[model samples]
Target: MGFINDLAAKFTFRPGRGRKEQNGLLAEELAALAKKIERLAREQYKANILAEQSISMIHEQRAGLREEIRAGAIRELAMGLAGDLLPIIDGILACLDFAGENESLRAGLRSVLDRAEVALARYGITPIEALGGKFNPSLHNAVEVVEVSDLPPEIVLKEITRGYRLGEAVIRYSEVAVSKSQTGTVWPGME
Candidate 1:
């Protein structure tokens, strides 16, 4: 009986040692679980930041696209308006030339010109100064060359037709008479 009891006692687990070992294992497992949770939390934070950045980029792209669309619409509108006004301006200039020395007719023509200028100014349109200025091929179409002793060669002496610009864009180029030196070097396009 004593031998059997001794063997049973040897094989049986003691509460104190078992509880201590179980507690140690539980603590290790809890620590590992805490580390895993912290890692997951950090990953979640990084993912959130990435999502926010993506959203911001999308918003900026959308805004840029909207601005481009608006600018295109404005450009189209300005072109159409300028095209409509060109013929009217030419007619007014013709009338002014034909008014001659009649004071009343000249006054009326000047008033019309003023109104036209106001309308053009509303859309950023303005005339390019050609007469008495240096001839620029980009702004002026040289229709004729006049012999001039006072002015330098290539200087614009007269404007046959006025030129206009809308925000740095030439809507029309001036038909101009350029000065030629007495030497008659034969300006370009003249045989």
Candidate 2:
């Protein structure tokens, strides 16, 4: 009977005792809910940080691609412009070549050529000097060599083809006739 009574007491509730027990259960449930809320807040903060980082990385990649595209376009335009100017340079050189055999028209052709050169100069183009100057393998290609007693050796005696430059870049090398030493001894350096 005592065992039976203890069992009954475990299931049975006194009025005040039952109310306090129910309130304690509610408090425990609320504490558990607060812990879940804190975990959700931490997760939200991490997701926001990751999203910001991803946005920043994408922005940097887009900027780099844009800069590369701009540079490539600029390079292509510059190359095309240079190709177009090559034909003009060739035409001027051809005129100079034909002028050599015609003495009567040479002066008039020279005036026209000079005007063209001046116009090119206005746009940053110029001809390289070859005749009677020191031999520079960088800007002059020797097609023939002549031995002259009066002229200094290694001097440019004639220009076969005119060479040109744009800014500091050489477009063509001048085909020239360079002089060799006549006496078989190296000529003294020129003054």
Candidate 3:
């Protein structure tokens, strides 16, 4: 019976408990809930800011990629036009050789060729160095091999037709005559 009475007392509310105290406890619980909600809101705001920054960075990268592609296309077009003009320029040069006695015709041909060269310069097209320089398979295509005793073998003796380049890319390889030493002076420095 004593155990049963103790259990009953635990379940019952004491007479000292008042509505004022219950209201204070409820207010404290509500304040704690409000603090938790504020913290969550601040975290959500920071996440949104980070997401916006990521999106902006992605947009900038995409724009840069587009610019690079456009520039590459322009470069290719200019190179193609320059290649087509080279044959005409070479023909004008060949005419100068035949115009030995005709000074007026030679001068006129030279002027026309000079104007064409100036136009090519606007697009950064330039001729490759070949004559009197060491032969490079990439820049010069050997059209003839001449036997010489003084100069080193593989040296470019003459440029038959001019080669051209746009920056690092070769538009056409120069047709050239390369030298072959007859006396077997293979190493210039050794002598």
TM-score of 2: 0.51
Model 3 scores worst on lDDT over the 10 consecutive residues at 3-12
Per-residue lDDT of model 1, residues 77-159, tens digit only: 87788788878888988888888899899899889888987888887888999999989999999999998766568899878
lDDT of 2 by residue, 68-97 (tens): 998677555544554566466567657767
Order of candidate numbers by TM-score, starting with the best:
1, 3, 2
**How many pairs of residues in model 2 come into backbone collision?**
0
Per-residue lDDT for 27 in model 2? 78
Best by TM-score: 1
Better candidate number, 1 or 3, judged by TM-score: 1
Taking all chains together, each candidate's TM-score versus the true structure is: 0.66, 0.51, 0.64
Query: What does candidate 3's lDDT look like per residue over 1-191, in tens digits?
Result: 67447545644566888877866765776687689779989999999999999999989988998899887887887787786888899999888888998999999999998898888878878889999999999899999999998888899998889888887888889999999888656755646
C-alpha lDDT of residue 98 in model 1? 89
- Who is ahead in TM-score, 1 or 2? 1
